[model samples]
Target: MKIRSVLSAAVLAVAATFTSAQAFAQDTFTLKMAETWGPNFPIFGDTTKNFAKSVETMSNGRLKIRIDSANKHKAPLGVFDMVKAGQYDMGHSASYYWKGKVPETLFFTSMPFGMNAMEQYAWFYHGGGMELMQEVYGAHNMLSFPGGNTGVQMGGWFREEIKSLDDLKGLKMRIPGFAGEVFAEVGVNPTNIAPGELYTALERNTIDAVEWVGPALDLRLGFQQIADYYYTGWHEPATELQFLINKKVWEKLPADLKEILRVAMRTASYDMLVLSQHANAEAWANIKKDYPNVQIKQFPQDIFQAMYDANKKLLKEASASNEQAARIVKSQQDYLAQSRAYTDISERAYLNTMGTVE
Candidate 1:
């Protein structure tokens, strides 16, 4: 009887230990995310959805991301502040959107006449861009990762043709970020208008031009109906959106879950670039076929030269003001020069050759 009681007690203790271990093994975590985009906002929205799905799948339900769009949060531009303050565990927005609050945040998004999508992605992964971006966001107790890319955005939708630098003078435009500053330097009056109000503003002649995303997103806003001229891109060759994670939230995540989040964000960012290319191609074809009144135009040589000079000057000023900004700018400039040289020989040469073939 004594031996049987001892064995029973030992077996009960082992079972309790096993149960505790199982519970720990099956522990789960859920992170709430706030996005700058409205509900079901095409490419931008799709990226976040993809990220959430990937995280859940990769973690086998151990980790989950619950996303709230601008409509739910009612604060499209408040992503950075909310994420930094721990109001949200994560956020999806452009880094430049917070430039007013943190000036160094401007450089994470594309600059005027900067690297293209491929070049910029390379820079982020291989050329110290991610480290520099983290340095900027770290001060705010957040971590920033590349959320997505818009590829090379169209310069803008203009009501009339831009003949020269003079055409930019006194031009009221809906442009944002560092690009807006560049335009302001070139004598344009740059204004910030909400995305929902862009069409009305243009239709009412409140703004002479609007610079939004590429064909994929711009078409949805019906800019073609109000604007006659669509200009080629120069300002934002690769506008990279950001994923913000609060440092405390990130630190609390288990190692495996952290890696899962990283991979999910990275993959989603690249996916958006490909998706943008595909969607833009289809949208451009539709616009050409349906919108006969729309004309595609490039800025004149003198205008491009002037804007280029203005961009360089602004960059210098930014770098001069902040030591970290100087390092980031120089890193990007150096990487771009090196990457572009090869791109000019390979992609550019091939495209130029193909242009004459047909």
Candidate 2:
């Protein structure tokens, strides 16, 4: 009697385990994503691909993500809208790109002369940045996560070397976000151009200059062939991209799947920064050897001062306009002030010391 009872209890335990496994297996889901980049467009596109693959792998086929690039979607800049409308379950793009519609979105991306990648990441995860971002996106019926980082972007590709502030005046450049507003304040006509149109726009003289991204992506787009001068970056120091999901779609996801997506997005975002460092370093070396006509330049000190002043002015104006913008701006400013002090003594000091070596 005792042996029979033991065997029956063991069989019941196995049956329960099998039933649980079956339930999980039957709850399979597939999500659709749209990206701003064209198909397989280097680091930016690679971020999305890596993210989708990681989600599927981690979930062990219980969850799958299907990515649609700009080529298929036919809207490179409409990612926020598509995801919000639930036309796509998710979107991979930059947050600042939507600043015209949501002014607070600009702060979530890199601010001009703001924190670097490391500092910005700290602010996002540790500081109040994530909550603030959710507050902004939640209103739009979407959830936003950090998609990727491009480190520091090049200021732009210029046809001719800019000697002074006068050179920037009346110059039509493809620059976006609050940086564009700052540029506009300093007399630059800042315009937002889709990534695919950048080469043609610059080649055809539709725009005088373009600030697409750093070398990894700019090189892929063949910007070096037509533009003679590449300037150092000041506008977008960290340039964190965004992964957006419809709030409704996210709410419908199982808790386990939501956590999986979160982990995948965070890992993918960090990986892009690493990949960018590797690819940009290699591309820079190649540029030096092959692109003889491409001269690297820096904006004059006066130009920097003017734009800095413009940035301050715009921040004040934006804060004055909206309560939420005020909170975000204040939060960012306070965080930057606290974080950058350490950065100056640590990373900046280390870099300065290294500059003297041989």
Candidate 3:
């Protein structure tokens, strides 16, 4: 009887220990995220919300992401600082926005005449883009991942037709990032304006042109009614937004939770690209029907040639300044050259064939 009682006590203690351990493993965590976009701001905003939902679901409620849009944070462009300082655990914004603070960051976002969405994603995951991005962000105490891609952005809404390269001179435009620098090189005065004020600025003639995202997002700003010329894009061929996580916060997460967050972010990024395509197509169709005055135009050969040259010169200068920038630029140029060759022969060729048939 004494032996049986001792065995029973040992079994009870083991059961209690096991139960405690199981409860600890199921501990829940909630993270705060800051975004550059306004609340409910079309595709960009949706991406964050979708990511949050995905993380919650994949983690089975063990992890939750609370998002604060620009309105809540009151600092649209301060996402990087907020996340890095641990004011927010994560951030959603374009990496290029921090170029002034971190020059190497500019390479993570799209480049002028760079690879399109598909090729860039390939470079990111399969190639060394992710590793390079980490090297840039790791110093800031943050980890960066691709948040979303806007495929190829439209150039901008111009009030006047760009007949030649001369038209770009002295033109004040709301353009941002590396492309803005390229525009400046070509004699255009590039300025950064808040998205909320872009329409008013353009309408009031405070700005001569605005280079927002493509049709889906630009339509919301009513640019079609205000500006006639919707020029095609050469800059920001694949404007990829970023998901930035504070390194400490990320490290604190359990391995399972970490994977859930990573997968959620990646899935959300790809989803945004698909959503951009669908939404842009629908928005373009609507513009064609409702706004007949909005004419789609491409920059003339001379203007493109000059801007392309300017882009190369600017990239060369950027590379010369930093060794990392030089490596990133070379990697992109090399990948683009190789990828585009195959793309031209396959995707472009098929599209060209279809156009001829139709």
Per-candidate RMSD vs. true structure?
A: 1.7, 4.0, 2.3
Taking the tens digit of each residue's C-alpha lDDT, what string does model 2 give over 322-347?
Answer: 99999998888899999999999999
Estimated TM-score for each candidate: 0.96, 0.90, 0.94
- Can you list the residue pairs that collide in candidate 1? none
- Find the 10 residues in a row with the least total lDDT in model 1: 22-31
User: For model 3, how does the per-residue alpha-carbon lDDT over 1-358 read when each residue is reduced to its tens digit?
Assistant: 9999999999999999998998889989999999998899899999999899989988889999999998899998899999999999999999988988999999888989999999999999887999999999999999999999899999999999999878999999999777888899889999999778999999999999999889998998998988999999999899899999999999999999999999999999999999999999999999999999999999999888888999999999999979999999999999999999999999999999999984
State which candidate, 2 or 3, has the greater lDDT. 3
Candidate 2 positional error at 320, Å: 0.6
Question: How do the residues 1-358 of candidate 1 rate in per-residue lDDT, one tens digit apiece?
Answer: 9999999999999999998998787778899999998899899999999999989999999999999999899999999999999999999999988888888888888988899989998999999998999889999999999999989999999998999888899999999778898899999999999887999999999999999888888999999998989999999999899999999999988889999999999999999999999999999999999999999999999889989999999999998879988999999999999999999999999999999985
lDDT of 3 at 341: 98
Q: Show where candidate 1 strays beyond 4 Å.
A: 1-12
Clashes of 3: 0
Instruction: Tell me which of candidates 1 and 3 scores higher on TM-score.
Output: 1
TM-score of model 1 vs. true structure: 0.96
- Give the Cα error of residue 217 in candidate 2, in Å: 1.4
